[model samples]
Target: MNIKLLSGSVALALTIGVGAVPSGASEKPNVVLMLADNVGYGDIGAYGGGAMRGMPTPVLDQLAAEGLQLTQFLVEPGCTPSRAALMTGRYSVRSGLGTIILGGLPNTLQEEEFTLGEMFKSVGYSTAIVGKWHLGFEEQSWPTRQGFDEYRVGVIETSESTLYRPNMERARIDEATILEAVPHIYESDGQGNLTPVREYTLEYRRQIESDIADAAVNYIARQAAAETPFFLYIGWTHTHYPSLTAPEFTGKSTHRYGDAMMELDHRTGQVLQAIEDAGIEDNTIVLWMSDNGASPDAAPWPDKGGSNGPFRGELGDPTEGSIRTVGMIRWPEKIKPGKTNEMVAIHDILPTLASIVGADLPDDRPYDGVDQSAFLLGQQDMSKREHLLTHVNNKVAALRWRHFRIYPKAYRGSFSNPSQEGLLGVQVEKNGGPDIFNIEMDPREEYSISGDNAWVVAQWLRFVAEYNESLREHPNPPGVTLTDPDFGK
Candidate 1:
């Protein structure tokens, strides 16, 4: 095992119990976190969505009704960045992943950082990540080294997908780089070693989601019978560009895009059923969400793709449609079934779970996430998160406080738009008045109140000032990106 220990003073101190768990909760609840790739805000039934023009997502809708639905959950604009934030409970930029991993190059989470998987393992919880482990593709950086006990991962660079070739064409990746991007599956044994399983190609692409879900179901049953709590992360690769639908679900929706989403719903339903069958549904915490908003301009999986519903802009932009996404949690009798208008982000998951498990966060580094256990447990009506900093390529693209958002300047892109070349000379001006919107009232961001609402504008600017001060107190540098030298042929 090649586990790199944390260095310096930060590694010297370890503090637990940052948030008080409710009394009389003895047994640690099992956790199952499901993440969809490139899904839109309105693409699920609970959010008024179906796979086709208005396909019905009965399973998701039922899950929302039985769980708590968060209306304004935010995530990073891209896949790798979002996953990084969710795992580390900090800004992706702090993890050197403010942007997606470039083609032919590998980017990974640092060894020093503590992850959600590690946090669970700290409390003696069995952990497994059954799908995409995009945090890092390198040997030492894989999930096994990061704390997962068992892993079934598909290794792919950010440029590759279920439909790898089409993505290469869209990104204009050279043939050599494209050849280096073959998709392969491997299983890990919670060490630095991995055993190759099979090649993931178009013929078998459609079955990936089902296979992952099946693996999760089996894990759940085994954990339940053994009397040990477990953490299962199902990273479903669906609804992204070149959305692949299983053969059985083909033509099940109005279009190929819808078909893919429908398939996602089906696979999710299977996992939920497994929880029920294992008789751990009430004692388990099930969470559903997406990595980020969907991109309508994704050329590889084009089919009048994705509807951000009323929100404006698309993935890769600072707009609400890019960050705000569908979020739900079902814990049977523990979590009251209802909805919350709270402002939460992917970064909050780690701290929230830490509080629930009565565990402590690492005392050494800066953590951007807050404990939302109180909010989830119904101890409080409001979320602990009050403000969020939205970024694009390490630059603060927008500042969000309460119900308002202030975009520093005009920005545009969705998935592959406004390439790295476009980001080079990009200038976000502060001289001209900023564009502000009361996201609560105008979810679409159609109207700007920056010119009319003086109080709101002043309040937002004040928040930014305070945030800047905090950033200075605990300065953060981006994580390291892998170069050819570090790739280790």
Candidate 2:
């Protein structure tokens, strides 16, 4: 591995409460990253939904109160893309995973790509990923191969795959054939051994998050007893399509989605409680965030219980609501608890965590994420990040710089085909010029202020030009596309 170690001065500067470490505590802190699927900005109480949306997330709301809430945390347009960025600290397009991966698709996280789990392992931390591993289905793409030391109670595909067996039954397919085709809940021993634990049935789907929470809690307990620090990535399946409430949580809220939210909140509390019980609250860093904005295509009418707060657009569009979601981080006494409008993206997590653990990033590849350890530690008044580029299907859809959102290619939700829009929306390519919106004043993005902000467009173009120039030396891998004949090659 091409690695660089941080100097003593740099490492000490990043530590909070420098001289206040407990006698035998490890120098590096344990990191727990909880990622919720298809949750919107307004879905959580801290962002404005919660009780008002008929699902009171007391545990999550309280977690926000005790931590630093991020009002403008950004992600990619879909689950796979967001996860790819979170793992690699680079744009999803660079990894050829700019869109959601399908079951039989060849798009996988390559062995050459260094992941967050590998980074943590490099610094002597035990690493594990519990829950959804959607990067690919190949053995080489498994979590164990990517960087996680253990993978448990998870699926290699999306939650929607739970419906495959029933759908196949409706088509009069044989049970044996259906069983052969559908995926099952799997676990890995981090030694090239992957095993199927159980069938991923719809009934199992209802209790999947609960199962994941239990596994994560167990992992935390075991690691707390060890000398090495740990990194746990929990990919929660909640508020996604086919949202099902566990038997215990049924009718707890107004709708199925709300009931699922209640379950998510409660199960997350279980993991938090485990951390507290293990007596590692002061030394552990926990980050709770959503992978993407809510999906209107998940359900219809009252059952479709998700809001984008004040932003426009939904999950798959290149709009504010599509990419922006809830994000919060807590590290007792180290980070002050408050809300900030400063920008942060999913890709920044790996680099930020690497900085906190005193591990140098690999020098073999270019990284899009800048280290925000100083800003996050309260040493700076503003975030180090000022601009972010959003992509869909490997193409530049929008650019967010400061308060301005510039769209070279715009899209809108299609009423005729909501599901199609949620995957790949209807594009509006010819808009005279780039559309600009001052997100601070117009959060909904109702009117374009491009005519008045010509300078903003100029700045955006310059950034894009520089990025394009860098591609000459290190071109991105082939992006996955349905129409590409050589896809997965």
Question: Each candidate's TM vs. the true structure?
Answer: 0.86, 0.93
Backbone clashes counted, model 2: 0
User: lDDT tens digits, residues 1-489, model 2?
Assistant: 233221110122334322233423376799999999899999888889899988999999999999999998999988999999999988888888898887777788888888999988888889899998799877778889887889999778788777788899999999888887787999886375789989888888888988999999999999999999999999998878678878989899888888888899999999999999999999899999998999765444544877789988878777899899999999999889999989988878887887677666677676677666777888778786778888877888888888999998667655574334555457777548888999999999988898988789886787677667666766888877774576556
Give one digit per residue, the lDDT tens place, for model 1 in 218-305.
9888888865688999998877656667888888877777888888888899999999999988889999999888776543445546
Specify the poorest-scoring 10-residue window by lDDT in model 1.
1-10
lDDT of residue 302 for candidate 1:
51
Misplaced by over 4 Å in model 1 are 1-26, 153-178, 190-192, 299-303, 413-431, 454-457, 470-474, 479-489
